[model samples]
Target chain A: MSTLLECKGLFKSYSGRPALKNVNLAIESGHIVGLLGPNGSGKTTLIKLINGLLTPTQGELYINQNPVGVESKKIVSYLPDHTYLDMNLKVRDIISYFMDFYEDFDEKKAYDMLSKLRINPGDKLNTMSKGTKEKVQLILVMSRRAKLYVLDEPIAGVDPAARDYILDIILSNYEEDATILISTHLIADIENILDQVIFLKHGEISLISSVDDIRSGQGKSVDALFREVFRC
Target chain B: MLGKYMKHEFKETGKLMIPLNLVILVFTLLGMVMLGSRLLSTPAMALIGIASLTLYILTLFAIFIVVYVYFTVRFYKTMYQSQGYLTHTLPLSTGSIVNTKVFVSLFWVTVTVVFTTLSIIALVYTAMGQEWGKMAVDSDISFLKELLFSFLLPCFSLTILGCLEQLLMIYASLAIGQLFRQYRVLASIGTFFVFYIALQILGTLTMFFTQFFSMDRLFHISENISGDSFIPFYRQLFSVSTIEVIVFCIVFYILCYWLTDKKLNLE
Candidate 1:
């Protein structure tokens, strides 16, 4: 029950307009948590704040009880909403770079993941299709034995087949002791895999419940409750 | 990390630089050819020497432009666009990246200037049939040093300033400009204009203060007011001193690094 991430009264804005407002969240290790929200509901912002990509304007965020900074960044594997990989690098070169910089990067696991996806290490990123590129990025991030994995819209811009493959890769590669916070609007697709779900609406938590609790206590699936709660 | 950073810097820089170096090589070769053709038919050896020297000066100018533009563009794109986000975000300290880039820039500038000078000297010696050394001795070896310093010193100082200015202006420009996605380019230009005006105002203020107070400290102009009128204006270059230049460079680097490290939106 050790906390992997903690956010208290987190606030953020762009150009004086609020993106996130006094949002509080806490996640513990060894759980697959689905972060369900409508578009522009600050799911990505919260993930970004946790990853130290965007500094919070107000309040505090901690990763593994440490403040978010270079140290936190080192232990957090962040898969950004967009591709962060340089398009000019070969897959092998990119792997070497991560292996050189990150202490926790698992080269063997990365290679195995790539082989499973049939992605050649010699292939240039620019030459790969967008879906394949996302797969490569996912492989690289998940190859790390990070304390927490922050995946922002990993399945957004891909084919259904590719999405399933990505999910499978994520499930297989994630360390058993680590936590994962996956932010997406596609709740039905991810509900089966997620042990816990956090529903966000207009930058506030609408619901946070375990899948078993949702089914047993309310006699309803997490997806049905999500649709009911977030109905327009 | 710095070694890897410089390796990529050199690799990417060489892509544009090799062509510029070749252009300087061809200019030197052509100047040599022209001098050789003239020397074959003329008895006026001094005139030939003079003509060769003029061509050498022109080649030096060409060298300066090629290297300056190549480094400017190469450094900007690589440092800002490709590797900058990674560099700024990494656990490494800020001073390391700045120092590495400054050294790399100075390295390329020195290489370009020295190689171009050597190429010109080689061409001159080849065209003049071993009399090049005699010409140098006759013209006083001091004259060659003077010629080099005269041609390169101002350009060198300006090149350093140009690099620092671009580094500062571009970072601030990008930071402010990136706030607006729709008119980012226009905003960048506006920022540059504002920064340029601010720099000019600073320069004017410095001039006014120096003229009012540093007349004695800068010029020792009490010798002869009328005779040393030009000295006050001309010696500002010498009076500002190298320490001032170094301090300004440090300040500019710190400002650039701070803005880049804090405000970067790696979109």
Candidate 2:
């Protein structure tokens, strides 16, 4: 598999405080990777940098060997941690909106997912429960045939059952050659599904290893190892 | 892509604008009916007339406030707030995004101004009947033609240019303000006032310098001057302001696009 993402000495700072500092990493295709970190560990900041929401203070980051830009945005499907959909729009309107901007958007698949979730297409976003809105956003992001999926804390807000459903949807919907980078702190819940795990601490990547390697070498689960490494 | 962006922008803004426009139309018609007719003999009719007129005026005021506030708020909310997660991720150039917004905003503002002007004209036409038309036709033909061609048309164009300049100034201010980590909204408001004051000072300096250099003499004609001289004089005056407005628009647009593309700091 070829490399899908590269960050060389990636550094981002806000008000002279470092959010991500001297981070170098590469992601290859066809694997689900967990970007595990505690709160304020620069997980979301890294995700936003990938999505072009914030410019880097120094260094370089690239997607598919191309620098972060409109072209990179075209091939990356991103789901932010917060509710980003316009509240005044209905579910159907937002679907159309996604379809209009993303040429790779699958309208039929999106509608099918909405139906499975028992979400009416005509329901206004403001009226939907927070979980339902998150589901809608996930469905939209997953419906795109993108080369990279950058999901920031995708399963954080949903219930356990809904989390399973979301994981299932994510696991089943992406292309075979695409890479998934899921940023979350719920390591135990998603450890089984992640082929590789990256542990971030204090604006730096402390560990990057395959799940099987961590289990075999450390003789413990990834979550247990994470607790050992990042324990206060 | 710009077309798609503009289409969505229009749809979103139209939801608020269409209803407001309808209200304006309905109230304008009601006012015409109340004022144009002679149904004010009784105290009740007189009170109704006054109430309807007041409502009509208030609705007109609401149209202006609502449209301006809606566009400004929509720009801030969609581009800087949570919705920015969706907006900035789109596979389009920042220029296209900013241009689509500026165009749609200008479109709606123009519609509101035109609608308000037409509503007032209609009201006056209803009240004056044929007298207004006869008076317009009986005026000095050469003078009327000169006024329309030299003054009114230039003023109309300048009004539009000025509107675009102001809208872009707001956009640039918001873009600069979002770079702040805290007090982003307050920063944006401060940026706007700073830009406003700077522009005011620049305008005053320009006017002062022009007067100092006796540029106004170009437009000051003797009372005995012929009608043909009016066109050249007005054209010169209009060109200076037009060029200035265009420059401001370009500068503001570049600032907005650069800040959005290079220095985006979305929350």
Each prediction's interface RMSD?
A: 3.4, 0.9
lDDT of 2 at B13: 84
Tens-digit per-residue lDDT, B165-242, candidate 2: 989988988898899999988998999999999989988886666556655554465653676765676676678778
Q: How well does each candidate superpose onto the true structure, as a TM-score?
A: 0.80, 0.94
TM-score, candidate 2, is: 0.94
- Quote model 1's TM-score: 0.80
- The candidate scoring highest on TM-score is 2
Fraction of true contacts reproduced, model 2? 0.89
- CA shift of B223, model 2, Å: 5.6
Clashing pairs in 2: none
lDDT of 2 by residue, A1-232 (tens): 7889999999999989999989999999998999999999999999999999999999999999999888999999999998998888899998999999999999999999999999999999999989999999999999999999999999996789998999999998997889999999999889989999989999999999999999998899999999999999
Docking class of 1: acceptable
For candidate 2 chain B, which ten residues in a row score worst on lDDT? B215-224
